[model samples]
Target: MIGLVLAAGAGRRLRPYTDTLPKALVPVDPAGEGTTTVLDLTLGNFAEVGLKDAAIVVGYRSEAVVERQAALEKKYGVKLHLVHNDKAEEWNNAYSLWCARDVIAEGVILANGDTVHPVSVERSLLDARGNGQQIILALDTVKTLADEEMKVVADPAKGVRRITKLMDPAAASGEYIGVTLIEPTAAAPLADALKATYERDPQLYYEDGYQELVDRGFQVDTAAIGTVSWVEIDNHDDLNRAREIACQY
Candidate 1:
């Protein structure tokens, strides 16, 4: 499977750094030598998990990634394919993911570019794959639920019943940690679902696309990444948490 990352957001909250780089480029590892990004670790993780070919959907300061493409490729030993999202500045990640639908058929291990997690997370998804399951999301069943988290109500046999941030925190089974395994079989429908999601609302997240799948009677599965030290860097506090654990990865 190929590695797919959605790294197009401008990360308005990240200011100065994101002023010139995408959210994925914000530095999370304080001790990491010359490493200025979560994408660096993400590519490294992909290589570690045996994904040599990867695609990154980029927009908003995308040139920064182009300038570092060769160096990133050489450093991680993974071939980088960039999928450009022209609407990145004007839209959310549903569009960013849809921008890479062409590669979804290759079977993908997709990770949100703004998240900082270890290679073990990818390894877990790889191990949990199959059993006729078409799509698998990395769920953090251990984390405490909050209003901001992308929550889910999953059934052991019925798969994900719902996936969205608007749901009540108390009713959620877990939080979607922004990693997914999309098999080739799920590609066409998922691409269609994402397309419909973005067209319905430009501001909607890709998780909303998963909701559309659930709405369409598709069985979207989940794999719990148990008690892993990971963080989605949405603001300064999250960036601090990421730095604390990124070096360990």
Candidate 2:
């Protein structure tokens, strides 16, 4: 299986830092031994989980990643593959993921480039393998629900029944933490679902693609990372939290 990261979005909320570099390259660790990017921690987690190869979908200052390609591979001990998203700046991540459909066939532990989580989360997903679930999402059921969070409503017998940001916070079972294990059997269908999502609305998030799958009767299960400290770096506040959490790892 290959590790996949969707690093295409132009994080507009993050200004000057994202002006020259993509959000994935934004340094989450400034006072450490050296600079540590969000992508660094992500690739590190993948390597820790025994994934030797990874594909990163890049856009909006893709050159930043191009320059660090070799160093990141050397640091993480993983072969890096770059997948370009032509419409990255024009659309949301639903299309960004669809751009990597070719590598999806290899089976992937896909993570968002903007999230900083521990290796334990990756291990949880990897450990849940062979359970007959094609798609396994790393969920944080312990976290308090919020309106901005991508909420999930899961059924014990049917797995993930719904996933979206518009759902009522009171009805959500947990937050989908941008990490997912997509087996080879589910990749093709997932890619198709993603295509349909972007075709309908370019602003739709990749989580919407999972909802499409759930609507089609695909079972998307979850592996809970209980009380783990992780943050999705969307704005300045999230970046600060990411720095604190990243230091612990």
Candidate 3:
């Protein structure tokens, strides 16, 4: 399986910093050994988990990633493949992930470019691979649920019953932390779901694609990343929290 990262979002809320760079390139560890982009942390985690081959979907000032590709490869010790998302700035990540269908067909530990989490999250997913779930998500069951978070409701016997950002916070069991393990059997269906999701609504998130798969009778499971420090960098506050937590790794 390869490591797949969705790094195409424009992150309009993070202006100035995102003016010339994609959100994945935004520095989270400013005071570390050198600058550390969210992509850096992601690739590093994947490498640590022995996923040496990785594919990154890029758009919205994608030149920045092209320029840094070699350096990032050298730094993380992983082979990097680039997938272009033509509608990155125009559509949401459902399309961004679908753009990588060709590369991730074998299988993938898919991560969002904007999230910062430790290698433990990757390890948990890998360790649980024997559980035989087709698609497994890294969920933060310990965190407080909020409306903006991608929430999930799991059935003890059936696995994930629902996953979405629109679910009522009071009813959610946990938040999906943008990390997923998609086995080969589920990749094609996931790509189809993602395609259908984007076709239905360009603004919908890739989580909606998971909802589609679940609705189609696929069992999407979850692995709890208990009390792990992580943040999804969406705005200034999230970036600050990422900076604080990223250095801990």
Candidate 4:
């Protein structure tokens, strides 16, 4: 499966630190706890999952991102595919997804560059592929989920049916982790929906397009990922938690 790393966010909250570089380029050490850098760990984790052919969707100081990724590819010996999104600063994660639409034609795994997730989660997502299922978003039922984290409402029984998207912090039952698996068939529909939304409202997030697919009849499964070590680092607190968790590996 192809691995698509969304490494384009500007990380506005990260301020001065991010003023010079993308958040994904921030250091994260798996062995030393938040000491290494997120970009290294993210790429290394993908390699550990048996993913060799990987793509990184970059924007917002993409030059730095490209240089870093190139160095990583050489050091790790993993094939790296670079795709650029000029409007990364204007759009959401969905725009990054759109940039990689053509390059990825089969089953692929999607991950955010600024997050550290359990290695097993990536494997489970790739294993959950089936017919007519274009995307399988990894989710876990946590006691407290922040508003910044992506949340979703899923069916109680099937565990595969996703009812709706939840961005409001107060009205959420589960938090979506950083990674998702997508099949080739679901790309075009998602892309088309996104284009329509972009034309209508350029500020819409990528989830809007996913919701559009759901509204137009698409089966995007929600794979339950319970009790996993998944953390998305966007601020100092998240970085602290990432450091604590990284040491456990």
For model 1 the TM-score comes to 0.98
lDDT of each: 0.91, 0.91, 0.90, 0.73
| Residue 203's lDDT in candidate 3 | 87
Tens digit per residue, CA lDDT, model 3, 1-249? 989999898898888889988999998985633389899999999999898899999999999999999999999899999999998989988889889988768899999999999999999998888877899999899998888999999876788998988889889889999999989888788899999999999988889999999999989999888899999999999988899998899
Q: Which ten-residue region of model 1 has the weakest summed lDDT? A: 28-37
C-alpha lDDT of candidate 1 relative to the true structure: 0.91
lDDT of predicted model 2: 0.91
Off by over 4 Å in 1: 31-36
- Tens digit per residue, CA lDDT, model 4, 1-249: 778888888887777667877888765564533246677776677788887888888898788867666678876667888898998888776667777888656557888887777777776776666544578877777647765666776664434333234456566657777677878777788788777766667776666666677777776677767677768887877877877776665
TM match of model 2 to true structure: 0.97
Pairwise lDDT winner, candidates 1 and 4? 1
- Summed over model 4, clashes come to 4
Where is model 2 more than 4 Å wrong at Cα?
30-34
Give one digit per residue, the lDDT tens place, for model 1 in 123-195.
Answer: 8899987599999999999999989999999999989999888889999999999999999999999999999
Give the clashing pairs for model 1: none
Which 10 consecutive positions of candidate 4 have the poorest summed lDDT? 157-166
**Residue-level error in angstroms, candidate 2, position 121:** 0.6
